[model samples]
Target: MLFENQRVTPSVSGAGEFMKAALEGAEAIVLAQSSMEELVKVHKICRRRPGMKLLLHLDSMKGLSKTPEAVSFLAGYIKPDALITSSPQAAVEARRHGITSVLRCFAFDEESIDSSLKLIERANPDYVQVVPGVIPVTIRLMRAKTGLPVLAGGLVRTDADVCRAEKAGATGITSSCPDLWQAAYVSRAKRS
Candidate 1:
C-alpha cells in the first residue's frame, strides 16, 4: 500500500542532479548505476536524510564482490531499507538479514520469461521488478504467478506507460526520466 501511493522511486544514475532529484522526489530512492567507490558516500548522505527510505541496486554497482557475502556485507554496513538485485541468492541473503528484497527480472524472450518465472517462485522476493516496464501482459502474468507486488521499471518514457503499468496490476512504477516525476505524472499515476 505504501508503494501504491509512492510510485516514483527516482533511480539515481550519477552524482549531481540525478542524485539530487532522487532525494528531492518521493519518499524512497534507489541508488542505481553507481560505482563501488560511491557506495559509502551515497549511504552516508542518504542515512542523514530524515524519513527517507533508501534502496540500493546491487547489480548495477561496479567493483563489488558479486556474491551473497557482498549482500550480507552491504546489509550490515550500509543498512539500506531494501536492495534491488538480479541475483536470487542475493535476494535470499537480504531476506535472511531482515531487509526487503526486490528481485529484478528481464523478459526479453521465452527463455528469459521461463527463467524469470522459475526464479520468482524460488526467490519469493518482497517485490518483483520487470525491466523495460512496457509489457502489461507480462506484468499481469508475473503478478499471477508470483502473487507479489510488482514494480515496473526501465524504458518508462511517458505518463501513459505509468498508467498502463498501474492498470496492468503493477503495484508501482520506477523510472529514471525526471519528467515523469512532475506533479502531472504523479497525479496521473495516482488517479489511474
Candidate 2:
C-alpha cells in the first residue's frame, strides 16, 4: 500500500513519540523497541487517528516472539497495518496472515547487500526497508535489484537525508526525530 503522499513515517518506540508523531500528522508510524504492555495503549492512540498506518517492528519489540504464532496474535489482536521484520519466515507469515510485510535489511557492505537480496527472494515481502538510509547508492541498488518499494530507515536524521533518499528512489523514509516529521509534513504541504 502507498503511504498516501506522506514521505516521512515516524519511527516511534514510546508513548511520547507516538503522541508527538500523531499530533504532527504522520500518516504512518513504525512502532519499535516497545513492550507487549505498551501495544494496546499505542494501538488505542493510533486508532484515534483516522487512516493512520501502524507498522510494528517485530525484531526489536520486547516480549514478542518472532514466530508465526506471534504473527497470528499481532494480526488478530493488535491489527496493525503492516509488520516489519528481519526474519524471512516471519515476513512470509505476516503476508500469510493478510498483513503487509516489510523486510528490514542492513546494507552496510556488498556482502550484506547480497545477503539482503537473498532474504528478499526468500520473504517476497510487500516492501523492503533498507537501514542507514544515508547511503543513496545502496538505496538505488536495492530498488534496482528488488523492484519492491523501499522505505529508508536508520540514521535518517535530517531533511537533507530525506531528500537524498527520495532522490535515490526511496518510496518513503522512517525517522525517529519529531522535527523531521514536522519538516516533512511542511515540505509536502508546500509542494501541494
Candidate 3:
C-alpha cells in the first residue's frame, strides 16, 4: 500500500507488530504523534527503517490537538513526509513548512464527503484517508467524483476487505492485517 496509518502504541508488544508486520511492504506510514515524547519515539523507530516514509499525524486521540506546540515540536525532531489532521488551519500551516498535508475527514458522510471534495479541490492535498464504515455508500460515490487517490481505512481485517475497497474506487487499503498482505503475496506467487 502507498500509505498506512499507525497509531503509536505505548505497549512494546504492539510496536513490535507494527515494525515487523505493517512496515514490510508499505511505501509510507503515518504515526500518531499523541505527545511530544511519543512523537520522538515513533520518529526514532520509523527513521531507523530504510525505504519507509513517515508522516506525523496530529490526532486528538490523546488530547494533542489543543496544543499548538505539537507541530513545531515535532518539526524540530524530524521532517515528516506529511501531517494528518481534521483541522483546516493546521493543514494550511503544515504546507508552509514544505511538508505534504493530508486532511483526514475520519468518516464518510454527506457533509464530510462534500467537505472532503471541497478540501481536496482547495488545498490539493497529497492524498486523503476516509473510513468507509462511516458511510459505505459515500465511498463508492466519492470514488467516482474525485481523481485523487483514495485510501480505505478503519477496521479493515480481511483480504475481501482490501479487494472490496479497491473495487469501490480506492487505490488500495491501509490495514494492520499481515494476512491480507500475505494473501497478496501468495496470489502473486500463484500467478508466477
Each candidate's number of clashing pairs is 0, 0, 0
- lDDT string for model 2 (34-53, tens) is 98877788998878878777
Candidate 3 TM-score to native: 0.71
- Please provide, for model 1 over 1-192, each residue's C-alpha lDDT reduced to its tens digit, 9 standing for 90 to 100: 335657566777655534566445566767788886677777766767776667788888887654799988987888878889888998998899988999999976778989998998788899999997899998998888788998899998887898898889998888888887665454334564
Residue 116 in model 2: lDDT: 100
lDDT to native, each model: 0.79, 0.86, 0.55
Candidates ranked by TM-score: 2, 1, 3
- Displacement of residue 185 (Cα, Å) in model 1 is 4.0
| Candidate 3 Cα outliers beyond 4 Å, as residue runs | 1-14, 33-35, 60-63, 66-69, 133-136, 181-192
CA shift of 169, model 1, Å: 0.9
Angstrom error of the Cα, residue 102, model 1: value is: 0.8
Q: On residues 152-184, what C-alpha lDDT tens digit does candidate 3 reach at each position?
A: 666777556655665676654555445644434
TM-score each candidate: 0.89, 0.94, 0.71
lDDT (Cα, 0-100) at 63 in candidate 3:
43
| Superposed Cα deviation of residue 187, candidate 2 (Å) | 6.7
